[model samples]
Each structure stands twice: as C-alpha cells, then as structure tokens.
Target: MDLLPLAVSSVIFLLVSVFLYSWKLNSSGTKLPPGPRGLPILGYLPFLDRNLHLQFTILARKYGPIYRLWLGSKLCIVVSSPSLIKQVVRDQDTVFANRDPTIAALLGTGGVDIITSPYGPYWSNLRKLFASEMLSHANLDASYVLRRNEVRRAIRNVQEKIGTGVDIGELIFVTELNVVMSLLWGGTFEGEKRDRIGAEFREKVSKFIELLEKPNLSDFFPVLARFDFQGIAKEMKDLLPSFDEILDYVINDRLKIMDSEQVEGELPSAKRGKDFVQILLDLKEQNVAEESMTLTQIKVLLVYSTTIT
Candidate 1:
C-alpha cells in the first residue's frame, strides 16, 4: 500500500489539530475583528488580489473600519480609521511601537539597524545618536559646502548635456550619490574607478530593494525559513559582503590617513574635513559601551542613510 502519502496525511492532520486546538484555547473568550474564512493552511494569501490596497479597502467597507486577516499563519489586523491610527500611533504609541519584521528585513539589517530594530534601549540609543550627532544642525551646517559643490557639479553637467537631452532620473541619482558619498567619506573616485563604484553601488541597492519587496515563502512560513524557498535570503547574504567590502575600504582608508596624522603628532582638532564615518569612529573611541557603534553598525548606518534618502 501507499504508506508515504498516509504518513504525510497523518502529519498534516495532527498539525491542523494542534493548530486549531491552540487557537480555540487562546480565542475561547476573546472577540476578534471579523474577517473572511479562508482555506486550511494557506489562509487568504492565495486569494489576495494584486491590488492589495484596493482589496483592503473593499474588505474594510464590508468588515467595518477595522478587520483581521489570516495570511498563511500570520494574523494581520488592519485599521482603516484615522482616529484609530492616531490612537495607535500617538495616544498609545509605546504599546504598538515594536515591529514584527519579515525574514528578509531581519536579514538585511541583521536585526540591529534602526528601522527594523525592536523597541528597547538599543533603538533609543540609536535614535539619540542620529538626532544628536548625525542630523544635528551643526553637522548639517558643516556639510553645506559639500552639498553645494555636488549640486553645482550636477547643474553644470546637466547644462553641458542640455541639447542632446539627459536622463533626469539618472542625473538626480548621480548627484545624490556624489553628495551622500562626500558626506560619508569626503572622497571621490575618478575615471574608471568612479564609474565602477557608481555601478556597484547602484547594482547592490537595486538588489537590496528587489529582495526586500519580493515575497518569500520563508516570510509566510517561518518554519520553512531554512529552506530559503525563493532564494531571497541567499541573494541578500551574497549582496551584503560586497557592500561590506566597499565600506571597509572607505573606513580602512580613512583610518590609515588618521594613523599617519597621529604618527606625525597631529591632534584630532588638526584634521581637515570631518566625514560621518570619522564622527562615528570618534564616538566609538569614547567607549559609549552598550550604545557604542561597531564596524558593522557603521556600515549598516551608512547604507541606511544613503539608500533611504
């Protein structure tokens, strides 16, 4: 007889039983928002339209302002009312502040970056660092010259290419790239090296965004994460090292310069132009302890700041 199919069926039956039993136990006396009953195991995922927002609106109209959806095993609560959003975001902000990050996002940030990081001391410290050090008025003023120079360069380049026509998107991207790199490292590449760096950065950022947006089975089924069904995790892991190497090169180059200056007895005050990395390294040297920035953290922040902008 076919014992294999029978064994699989038995396992599935037991899993469903356990799932329902636990669900019943937890939900016995609780009232959940109304939602469409979905098929076993898959939930409402397979039935969702490509226009998810439209679908959500339709569901909200039928189910009232707030509704619940079971996407695979994940339970999603949707609130469409402005008052409810205000209550969640402003009135009781701390209660709902933490995020349940997807597998891809978790992998991308390594569970350490500001965006996907859970609400805690670490996130608070990072927020303070960003506000007090990175995006402070003084720092913005200091970066004005760099920003002005890059903007002027972009304008001049576009002016030169006016008659032939230029890709506005590409122009803006290049200009932004130059400005961000200048702020981060205070150095610019030239000729082939510049072209190569630009291509590399663009490629990696594209891949990162693509991976982030792609629906992975691992995200839907946490137990199946190790299998990496869509290979998004693998692609992300591979993409990360290249980004690390580039950041490492910039950091090491600056460190070498700083070391040479130190050897010549140059004080920290004597350093010419200060970049974001240098400022972060100084903070690291101050032994911020639990709030201290690591090399990985620095690189991650750099990526976050540039790409997010």
Candidate 2:
C-alpha cells in the first residue's frame, strides 16, 4: 500500500510537470529568430569568441542581420542593420524595454536603480524623476563650475608635466572621477581626507567594475544564481560593505551639515545651487505620494554616479 501511494504521488508530479512545460510552449506561441542550435543549458555562451565583434559579423552573415542566440537560459536578439535597430529601439521600444540584468549588477545596486529595474510603473517613475531632477537644465547649469574647476586642475597638472610625457588618458580619468565625486558631494571631505577617501574608492571601484565585467555561470544559468556557483555575487556582496562605509560617512557628514544649516539658515555647502546628492537627499526627506525614493535607492544612486569606469 505504501508503494502504491508513492507511485500515485510520482504520477501526479509527472503530470503537473508535463502540463507546465506544455503551457510554457503554448504561451510563447510567437516564433523566435532562427540561429545556431546550442547545447542544453550552456547555450551559445561556450561557443562565443573573445574577439566577439568578428564572431558576431560572421554570425550575421550566416543568420542574417536580425537573429537570435541563446545565452544559457537567456535569449538575445541581435539587430545589426540600422533600420532593424531603429525598429527595435524606437518602434518596438515598449515591447523590449525590460532588461536581463546580471546577478552581479543586482547585488551591487539591489536591482532598484533605473538601469536594473523592470519595465513597469516604478521604472517609468524613476525615468521621470531623472529627467526632471538629475538631467534638468538647472542641475547641469549648477554643476558647470565643478566641471570647469576640474578641467582647469587637469590643465595645470598637464602643464606641470609638459615635455615629461604625461599620460593624458590617466589625467582625464582622474579628472572625470573628481568631477563626478564633486557633483555627487562637494567639499564633504576636503584636502587629505578627500584624497584618502578617493584613493580608497578607486581601489574598491576597480574590483567592483572588474566583477561587473567578469562572466559568471549564475548570469547564464539563472537557476544557479541562488547558489552563486561562480562566486561573482559573493564578491559583489563583500564589496558592498566597503562602499557602504564611504557612502555612510559622506552622507552622515552631509546630514550633520544640513542640520546645522537648517538651524543657522545657510546653504553654503553649495556654491551656486544644490548638487545632485543634495537634491536626492531633499527628495529622500519628502513624502511625495508614489514618487518618493527609499534610502536604498538614494544610496545606490550615489554609488552608481561614481561608477564612471
């Protein structure tokens, strides 16, 4: 009788699995773009060449301009022709707005920021907020002095190293990072403290970007994402605390200053107007219905701003 019960249970499970699999095929009735067949699970990931541009060109010739490739569980539709690109990006934008973000990106930013969020009301709201607040003319105008000063500093550095063969690329990278940091938070950590913090940030940022670019099995086989079989997610988690430390110090320092400013009626932290960090902080304090951002969202925004690399 026990064996009979076990057999019945097995049959029921088999029936449910078959039903679900059939339903998946039925639901996705639309045909996918034809391309090379790949192995089960790994898909085309193993077959990808390091020289991916050349490989893609070869694939384009074989599969036509617009074709598909299965990267593990993920299906990628590549559009080579400009007309196809326009059709996908402009005409069919709504149909393809959602993105398949890597597990590292999710761990790094908590999947709430604009780039990681799904195509939904939350993403739409974030876009509207970014357009009206972050990319607004007033915000860019306010950041002009920060940009000019950083460029002038770079010029001075280059001038000092004239005929010494200064690496212009390195000079530009540091200058850009400084401008991003200043725009994110101006004069929060001045002089030695600022330089020290920037150096620490650069070290962490290097590892963070490295992990972001590194290929991981989890992103390919999402069923293994929870396992983090490749350790990409764990590395990202480890990097988070370091990022949090710097962010917490700067944010708390700013909060203290803002509190003092409130008491004394001063906004001297800003030269012309509030920078991006200040504006985000202001929004964080407000209780705007359905539009208010959370602390995680705010912190993620701040960290991502410095991810120029």
Candidate 3:
C-alpha cells in the first residue's frame, strides 16, 4: 500500500510539472514579429542601447523593418525604415492614431492630456482647438517676434562663448528651454533667476522624460502589474509636486494680470500678447468649451508644444 501511494504521488508530480511547463511556453508563444529571445521577465531590455534610434536602425539591418521586441512581456513592434513607418503611420493612419494607454502615458498625462486621450468627441474637440489655435499660421506669425528675439539672444551668447570650452549640447538645450519659456510666459528672465529656473525646469523635464521612458513590468506581464516592479507610481508621486508647482506659478501669474485688468475695468491693450495661456483663458471665458478643458489642460498643452518644437 505504501509503495502504491508513493508511485501515485510521483506520477502526479510529473504530470503537473509537464502541464505547467507547456502552459508557460504557450503563453509566451504568440505569432509575433521575429527577434531575439527575451529573458524570463526582463525581456529584451538588456539588449536595448541608450541611443534608441541608432540601435533600432542597427536592429533593422538584421531583423528587418518591422521587428518585434519583448519589452517585459509586452510585444513592441519597431518600425525603423521610412517605407515601413509610412505604411504603418500614414497608410493605416486611423488604426495607428489612438494612444495605447500604457501606465506611463496614464501617469504622465494624469489621464487627461489630449495626446493620451482615447478616440472620441472630446479628443476631436481638443484636437481641433489645438490645430486651429496653437498650430495655425496666424498664431505662429504672432509668436514669431518672441522666437526671433530669443534666437538672436542665443546666437549672441553662443558667439560670446565660442572661444571658451563649453558643451554645445548644453548651450543648445538652454537656448531651446529659454525659447519655450518665453513663449509660455510672454517674457524671458535673465541673470540668477533665469539660471535657477532653467536648472530646476530642466531637471524636472528630464525626470519626467526618464519616467515616461522607463519600462514598466506591468505593461508587459499582466500578472506582475499587481506588483508594480518599475515603481512608476512612486516616481510619479515624487515628480507631481514639482510639476504642479511650476504650473501653479504660471497660472497664478497669468491670473494676476487678468484680475488686475478686471479690477481696473479697463481694456488693457498693452498687456496683451497672444500667448497660449491667454488663448486658453479666453476659451474658458467664452463657455463654448469642453468639460475637460482646465488650467491643467492648458499647462499640458504648453508642455507638448514646447517639447514638439
């Protein structure tokens, strides 16, 4: 009786092990684009180079244009070649237009920004407003004076530092940040204040980008999502206060000017510049606006415009 029971237990263990192994293999075995085998859990994360574009180009040479990479458990399709990119992005535009709603996008956007919004009327309205107002040629022309002045200032500064040993990349980054700040704020700062604000804002923006780019295990492995291995939630909590502080300052400054005009009951023409904040405030006053449109929305829009430019 003892021998029979032992034999039964041994058989059961062998069968269970085989079943689990087969299940795991099958779960990982989907019809995906061919590429290197990812490690168990980490995926092909280790193989990824810091310069993603160049790395993808190199991979395209070996795995073709539309190769798949295992980012954690998620299957990431990489389209490197122009022809393939066009085919996926332009030829099948609608199918590719929607945001994927990954954890990173959700956290970065705070579930409201236009780019990360789902396809619907809300997104349509936001897109139309963005396209017609911010991206319009007229607005660009209006904003050109600010851009020109900032560029001139940057060129002069660069020329002054030509003989000195300086990192060109840092100089360019500062110039770009200054241009964006001028557009958003309707003025530029100088001296200590400029340096301090620039440093803080640059650090915040870099942290934001880093968080967005970091691989979340939850995105790949649904089961591991519960564990939050990437610590994305924690990172977001740390970054949110700084992000909110910057937005609050911009919003408060704009509001102060608007409030002062209202108190004086005067149409202050000289105080007017067609900045994004001004445009959004006007939209808010008009009441023909979507419910999702808020101060937060305006801030996010400004950020997107700056990043894109």
Candidate 4:
C-alpha cells in the first residue's frame, strides 16, 4: 500500500513537472506588452515581494505604463500610469467590465448579487435595482432612524467604557450590524433575541470576510481547485447553512406577517415603511423584470446589501 501511494505521488509530480516545462518552453506567436521575464511555470509568483504596490511600481518604471505579469498560470495586466488607467476604466469600460471572482466571493454571493454578477444585461438590471431600491434618497431617509439609533447606542456603550480601552473596529461592526438588522428585519427582534442573533451572525460574517481575503493555492493554479487542498471551499460551504438559518428565520417570519396582514385587509402603507428585506420580497413577488429572482438570489442580495453597506 505504501509503495503504491509513493508511486502515485511520484507520477503526479512528474506529470506536473512535464506540463510546467512544456508551458514554459512554448512561445506564443502574438506579441505581448513589455514585462520582466519570470521563472518557468510559477513565473513571478515565487519572486513576489511583500509590498506588492511598491514592487509593481518598480516594475512599471522598468517595463512602461502597461505590462504583463504571470502569477502561476494566471496572466495579469498591470496598468500604472494615470492616462492609461483612465483609458482602461473610462474610455474602454466595456472592454474590461467583468472581474474574475474568487472562490469565496462566488460562494458567498452565489454570483447573483450586483457585486459578483458578470457584466451583462442581468448585471445592469441589478445595478439599476441597487440605485432605485437600495441607494435611493428615499430609502436612505427612511433608514435614518435606524442609523441614528445604532450610532447613539454605540456612543452610549463607548461612554460607559470611559477610560478603558476600546476596539473601534468591533464597535463599528456592532453598530453597522445593528443598523442593518433593524433595516432588514424591521424591528421584529429586540433586546436578548437581537443580541444573540447579532453575536452569532457576527462570527459568521467575520469568518466570511476573512475567507474572502485568504490566499488559496487553487486561485493561482486552476487545476488544483477540485482538490480544495487549502480547505477554503470547505469553510465557505460550512458557513452557508448558518447563513440560511438566519435568513430563513427572518424571511419566513416576515412572510407570515405579510400574509396575516393581507388576510386582515391591512395595507402595506398602514404598517411602518417596508424594510430592505420586504422591498426585495415584494420585488420578487411582483416579477419586477423579465427575469424573476429566486429565493436564494434574494437571500444573497440581502446579505450583499447589508454587508457591503
């Protein structure tokens, strides 16, 4: 058994080495932008400095305004000059509209939310939805009380701390989470239930954020993605259930309330202004566009709207 395992490992290593050498030795006929020559297979990945910005700046001085860099098997184009950047971003926006979504980002948003969706008609629709529903002045003005209350609550907590040390990041996260919760759930939860939910949800969000930034080998080398050697995919999969639990609870609760009110002849206007969650729910029900959003998409949108804010 041990011998078989060793032989398999050696074969895998040999295959990878052969592929790398062939990839390195082969030259593309098409000319590419100027850049420093890098190592075989791995390219500049192994030679990367900790200060990426500074390293890229130095490379720009040597290579020119635009250059190509190979990180593992991935090819990256670095644009340094202001004029070139403007051309890429403004003049030729559609040419470079889409982004390569990371594993964590793809999982978290389900590629449905405005942030992760590919640049196309669906993405344009999401952007319009964001502007009209989420970022509208009316929506912001409506959420003012929630934001104010959260800020005041944060200040009071800080005041209580007095001279003791405080973690500004933690305080800010709590305040933001509270405001988001109020906006999403419409004050359905209060005091202990809210605190418990907040604490639990905070852990999940923090882990998800960290995972978003975590460097995974699979990202650099697509061939290794299926193996998930770093367990990044596993961690993200584990968190999804917890996300579903909270989302389902809140959504189901609100749905019940909406049904009750409809049966009782109570209009939506009679209640407090619809929250972000309610608005999204209503949008889906009304089939606001040619493509109706799924429940999962709504949940992802809710998460994106709350967290990105």
Considering lDDT, which of the candidate structures 1 and 4 is the better prediction for this target?
A: 4
TM-score of each: 0.85, 0.83, 0.75, 0.84
Candidate 3, 41-70: lDDT as tens digits? 556888888889888888888988778777
Worst 10 residues of 1 by lDDT: 267-276
Each candidate: how many clashes?
0, 0, 1, 0
Report the error of model 4 at residue 35, Å. Answer: 1.8
All candidates: CA RMSD in angstroms?
3.4, 5.6, 5.3, 3.8
Candidate 4 off by > 4 Å: 1-26, 159-170, 263-274
The local distance difference test score of model 2 is 0.77
| List of clashing residue pairs for candidate 1 | none
For all candidates in order, the CA lDDT equals 0.77, 0.77, 0.72, 0.79
- Misplaced by over 4 Å in model 3 are 1-65, 155-169, 188-199, 262-272, 288-292
How far residue 54's Cα lies from its native spot in candidate 1, in Å, is: 2.2
Specify the poorest-scoring 10-residue window by lDDT in model 2. 20-29
- TM-score-based ranking: 1, 4, 2, 3
